[model samples]
Target: MEFSQLIYRKQRRWNLFAIAAIVSLLLFSSLYLMVGEVFISPFSEVTPLMEQLVLQLRLPRLLTAIAIGASLAVSGAVLQVLLGNVLAEPGVLGISGGASVMMVLVLFFIPVFATPVGFMLAAVVGALLFTLLLVSFAQVARLTTTRLLLVGVALGILSGAVVTWAFYFSDDLSLRQLMYWLMGSVGGASWYHHILTLMLLPVLIWLCFKGQVLDKLMMGETHAKQLGIDVEAVRWKLILAVSVLVGGAVALGGVIGFVGLVVPHLLRLSLGSENRYLLPMSALSGAALLVFADIIARTSLDSAELPLGVVTTSIGAPIFIWMLVKNHDSR
Candidate 1:
């Protein structure tokens, strides 16, 4: 096929994928609205209780799930492209670990600072610190993407140890709170949380979109320099943007896993490796995945709801394992 024809075919595929994602999101939203205890069977018979549940409770949760999922997924896509590593995710880079550490500190010291804003601020600080540290390590070591992944793994392990120590020394109530946060859930989602997520997501998404220059940079530092792109500046900016995005999501919903890893990898496989389309498509696909997961979390059991992280892991781990096997085979 001609190069122009291939480009058109790729664009057509992405357009169709985007359309399917929209339709899926709509269906999931409708399902979320419709599947509660106070059931309204028909559209005409929808009552105040159902409306309240849908509008006040379900809608906020749905929006939060979408925001968190999309943020993490977009961040993942950006990191993957920037680092030129398919395995790179926000959580893998210790962003989530950093957030968890700050959250644990707040719970340990100033209990009153456990509010959403305080939590978000702490998470951002932690993530930014880690990002800087990681970048510095990369520079000093002249690290490859594989080396970056190892560094991230080490950081994550160290942070996990810190969190474990904090939990070990805490009281029952504090430990309980920390456990819930670590496991992740959308239980406390409110209009305020929704608003905060909405406000941050757009700015972060725009930054990721702006990082198209990094895509060119990935060809090599020499090539990027030739093209007049400041490779180091772009890398730092992408890191900061991802830190904020992932940190905010962690603050709101705790340490939900796999959405970042799962969504972007799936998109890369389906839509090919263009960050422009991969970023948005991953966001949409991630939102759809989390919304569906949340629906299962709420309605799967008898009285109490399951943790959203539990549901995601239950689904994501097998998929991840399968991908690992496939990757190994390909290699």
Candidate 2:
């Protein structure tokens, strides 16, 4: 009876988290659409220009935020479990940096990547390549969590150097575009971007279903395999999914940081580490957080919009510092 009650209590908490996330997502998404450079009331009549603004501009941007937030947050959660560390953001783990490097390389050299599919492929290739490098390095060095983070940082620096080298030879227009992407923005989201987002939503759903397998993995790889989890296959599957998702996110939203690092870790601490609740909640909370941040980024300054990364970094950097301090003190 006590065990059943405990299970019921856990379920209740999970439901509450899901409800809160949904409510927040709906509220913020509405605010994101309605409150912009000019306010548009959802119920009231508006001009064609306003209608177009909401449909063509704000909606796509909003959806892009959702896609990026959900994917990055989930990816971060998965990586934290896979790497057994808190500092597993896409940017930190070289995933986003890798994508950025490949993206710039393609933009500078490959005219075919001017298309959306080519752009996505380049980012995926970069992310996968970096994943391989990270795995190899970790295995070769027998990396502890700290060492893994350091290696990831080194990889990121290397990728940045490559991108910087490309920058010198690139034209001014490409340079400006690349800089905007590096900084991150949803200002330019279009129907093409929406197509990518739609394709990705199902994949995110599939990832959420991976929660059970991920939960098993947290118990240790050997234990998971003993329990018939196909540990290695699951590992590769998740890494590939994360690569595609992170690659898609970087391609779509540019290297927006900390959503993955911050969101999942916080959720784990607050709500408990059960992936079933954690994964879906992370997605919703991530979407809400990004929408909130994006709102602040564009609207905070009069007649000027800020980059998404600047806003997130300003907020996340402090949280990150606090996390490190707390973890260090605990140790």
Candidate 3:
């Protein structure tokens, strides 16, 4: 296709997908805020206590979910483009793993930093540390793409092993409480948590605007550099972006897995792999899916709630298999 024609096609896809995602997100988010323990209609008659519930509880939770979903999806899309692998995600770079390890430390070893703010701080720091380490490795080792990806996967596994050891050996918290952090949840949502998550929006926005550059990188590093893109600098920026977003997400929602992995792939199948459309659309769809999954997590059980990560992974696993099979058959 001609360059102009490709641009036109991408724009059309963006408009259509954006419209669909907005409608779906608004509908599901409204439903989410309404369908709690007390089934209150969003636009119907209300009481003061109900209003308080909506404001203090449901509203913050919904916002936090949106932030987490959007951040993960965009970061995942960026990583896929950067690493040239569909399986590339937040975990592939160990961002969430680093965050999880820090959270474990705060929960047990550092009692002074057990608050929400403290956890968020520690998580971001750990995430940045691992991300920078990866960048340094990429630079120093002059590793090929496949080798770099392997290194990232290895780091993530190492981080997970450390977290597992901490969870099992420590007696600071109950097994159930610590396990939920690993599985992921938004039940701890509050305005403070919401604010901490919102700080990542600027990074996400900057990344969404980087679709043109990312699209070039998708071609190949040599081709992208020939096209006047600073391939190395963009890689560093995107690495940092993914790290911060994933770190914040882990802090806010725990290690919610599938948003980063599945959202971008689903949109790629439906719309096309043009990053311009994929990035923003992924944000919208991610928000919608997370909010919807959260509703299932909240209402699935009669008495207690299910972990959000389990819910997403359960839903994503089958869909991921189907996607893989379809790709295989198409090839």
Order candidates by lDDT, high to low. 2, 3, 1
lDDT of 1 by residue, 1-331 (tens): 6999999999999999999999999998788877766554545566787778878988888889888888888877777766667777767677788888987798679989877888887888888888778767766777876578789978888988898887877678857766776778888889987656865766666865764575676688889889998888877777778888878888888888778888989887877877777777888888899999988998888778889989987887787777757866877
- Return the TM-score for each candidate structure: 0.91, 0.96, 0.88
TM-score quality measure for candidate 2: 0.96
Clashing pairs for model 2 are none
Ranking 1 against 2 by lDDT, winner: 2
* Per-candidate local distance difference test: 0.80, 0.86, 0.83
Summarize candidate 2's per-residue lDDT along 215-255 as a digit string, tens digits: 99899878898989987788788888888888888888888
Over 1-331, each residue of candidate 3 has an lDDT whose tens digit, in order, gives: 6999988987787798799899999999889888978898757788998999999999999998899999989988987786666756676567788888888778777888877678777888788788777667766877765577678778889988988887777675574486676778998888978667667889889998999898999899899999999988888788878877887899898888767879998788777888977898889988999999999999999899999988988988787667657655766
Strongest candidate by TM-score: 2
Better of 1 and 2 by TM-score: 2
Off by over 4 Å in 3: 1-10, 92-94, 129-157, 174-176, 323-331
Write down the RMSD of all candidates, one decimal each.
2.3, 1.4, 3.0
